[model samples]
Target: MKGPIAILGARSLLGRHVVNIFQELHPDVCLEMWTQSDGVGNVNSVKRLIACISEAELIINCHEARDLSMAPDREALHFHNEQFVAEVLRNSTAPIIHISSTLVQCSDFWPNTYEPEREASKYGIALAVKAYCKSKHLAEQELFASHRSAVVLRIPFLYGEEDWGSPVTDAVMAANIFGSIPNIGDRGGAFQIIIVGDDTPVGDVYDNVVEAVAKNPKRPMSTYNLPFLPLYYIYLAIGWLLLAVNKIFDVSGSLSKMPDPSLLYLIFHHWTFFNTNKSTNLLPDHEELSREYVVKKSRDHYALMNPNRVRTSWQLHIE
Candidate 1:
């Protein structure tokens, strides 16, 4: 753990947090950062990627294709998820810490050979999500097959101050503007969420990564679910009330547009929460944030970003 550490996808949401946390707490540690803009995942950049990590003692992969557009091309997903991972494995012998997603567990196409099926898919999950999950599952398979020292940290929904475009952030915005969330079937779906930009969980994730690098466990690869708090879809109503109060005091502004049905279904319809017993055992110091705290923080952050906009209420009129 003494040498330089390489971080792939250094510009991504989680990647940025990882970089900031490492720099803040361990400024002396050399960090080698590579991002998509730097051609880390391009087919023609294999040699460049190899050279990037050649001197690193540990590699942390935060690269992922999160664009779940309609009719997403399968090749694009594979190229970003599976093929890029394979390239990294081919290039670096450094022990790796990979950031993965819990959505893989909810895909119907995910094979049980890796781990037990966590939940059944709801009827209307977008095809883009299915394709993304399949690609991630394949990436995990690639890592397992490499027979290298690696730790896969599978996480649920992430929210924070900078994650402005994320689903949870969008929900908070919609609630603030409309004073209500669209009640998708069954009051939406259940899921788990964790804050990536906050110090507590980010520190926990970084601590586990450091342990993985230091220990280089005897097992070729280990998978752990990051700590999360359970959140039901209906709980989003809390944001509506919080924002409504802010508007009553003339402290918050409004924005238009509700989340698309496809995105809404993805969040509200699937059961994406997973057990974190293994991660807690690794580092039991994780703190849990209350739902109210998350809602209020998101509200204040949004209002600060859009402070001058006019306020709106349930009557579909600007105040």
Candidate 2:
């Protein structure tokens, strides 16, 4: 009999969705979920983690400190992002799948290669973002050093019904409340954005993890950037206009508030995007979602959550 698959950080935005999907799709598989409340992120809790996963055949680590504002200091970032990973590797022998960020790949240069020594300063990325990136990079290094069977999925900006604080979610929230999106930047950089719920990249993430668990490939480590729809910063202006129109016609009588500027640093600088050729080659049957479909699906999901809100004229036309 196979042991259960343990998911650490099971309460996260991605973690919750993964759990739900697994239950719905593969109900026969046993799953153990651990979150911050379970002391999963605490270095002292490694012993507890070891005990919990002792009977596990696979461990999926969705734990991460992603919010730039929340993880303000370097030590905090290192503790959550890198140190915890090292601790897990030291104790666990189970095949692991780690959820990493594409920010680790940010560079001003095109065709960014995997260079551990790459500095964030070269791309003029902000200090907080830089620290977060460095920590994720170090965590990856820790995994690689262990020479264990692990798969790292580097994902980009993710938005969904439950997502908040992320760039995409922030924009949506700001638009709904203030009728204006905060200034992101001069619109010079390239980016990729993906939805996290229902027939989106969340399924793709599951597919990759399933493949890793089944194959249990005997390589030191393998990394893949999940597929995404490429988007430029300039396209935000159109979204802003649509959001403003929706707010103006909203009958909910909700007063507008000022937009929060906390996440501005993440987008205020020029940053490069990832090339997912490796992921494509590996998942040849994977279908890429069109940008229009993603946008409409995301817009509808958020709109349904706030049912009193009216759709913009432009949005209706597009629909």
Candidate 3:
């Protein structure tokens, strides 16, 4: 019989994609999705959630708040994973993979730039993660506490789009919507950063969880950094290419006269990919970003999402 698979965070960005991929790859398996809705936690939606958890052989927890600047419910976040899920998961002997963020790594308290989930940066996101890391780490601890099996992927700067949340480029295009805001900073070309533009095969991180869980010796939860610098370079090249097009067609003009570098940097500089032992090892096997495809895809989606917004960003193709 096919194995039973439970996806704890089906409604999340990563959860949705992973679910689709898993279903496509393993169609025959029993696929169960769990997500909180209408003020009800995962169990509320399905009265048999605990039952499902008890019977399922593989449970992938992708449920977690991703916003960096925003404040999350510390009490709630900790309880869900530790007190609640821990109790339910304790009964199961199957392997469980918990999807976690790398907000913990951005710290100086530790001797190394990339330390375990224990030593996290205490600034901004890292600060926030530090508060919750204890719980997330505890969750991981519980998952392995029974000594069944577990894997925790410390992801950073995830990219791509979802039906609800705008694509990564959505932020980039939001300002461009009303036409150029003026170049308040440097003029030659404004450099905007994208998510760690790293070509790290993030997909492999997912794969490693599946592989690690299946094998023996119960793989220890190892945290990997999905660094950021790569996504920055990726967006830089894209920006330059666009500038070249503007020069060729003489499409240079200002709407507001001075573009706010601060505003632009807010969107650009923080975009990052990750530095993961798993992603680095796995991405090499797959193809990286396709700029041409991404450009077309991003623009089309942007237009659809913000129909009334100005379309000057597409002047190259329109007129």
Considering TM-score, which of the candidate structures 2 and 3 is the better prediction for this target? 2
Higher-scoring candidate on lDDT, 1 or 3: 1
Residue 246 lDDT in candidate 2? 54
Best-fitting candidate, scored by lDDT:
1
Worst 10 residues of 3 by lDDT: 310-319
Candidate 1 ranges beyond 4 A from true positions: 40-48, 107-128, 172-189, 197-266, 282-297, 306-319
lDDT of 1 at 229: 20
Regions of model 3 farther than 4 Å from truth: 38-46, 108-118, 121-129, 132-134, 163-273, 280-299, 306-319
Q: What is candidate 3's lDDT per residue for 171-239, written digit by digit as tens?
A: 334334534221121222212212222232323222311122211122222233323346445544655
Could you tell me the TM-score of candidate 3? 0.56
Q: Can you write out model 1's per-residue Cα lDDT over 1-319, one digit (the tens) per residue?
A: 5559999888877789788878876799999888777664355567667777888999989887754432344666788888888888877898888877776665422212224334224323533256666787788878878998988877765555555444444434444554533233332234455665332232222232212221122211224332222332343454455457656564333212322223334444544445666555542242465544654565455445441242211111100
For all predicted structures, in order, the TM-scores are 0.63, 0.62, 0.56
Compared with the true structure, all predictions reach lDDT values of 0.55, 0.54, 0.45
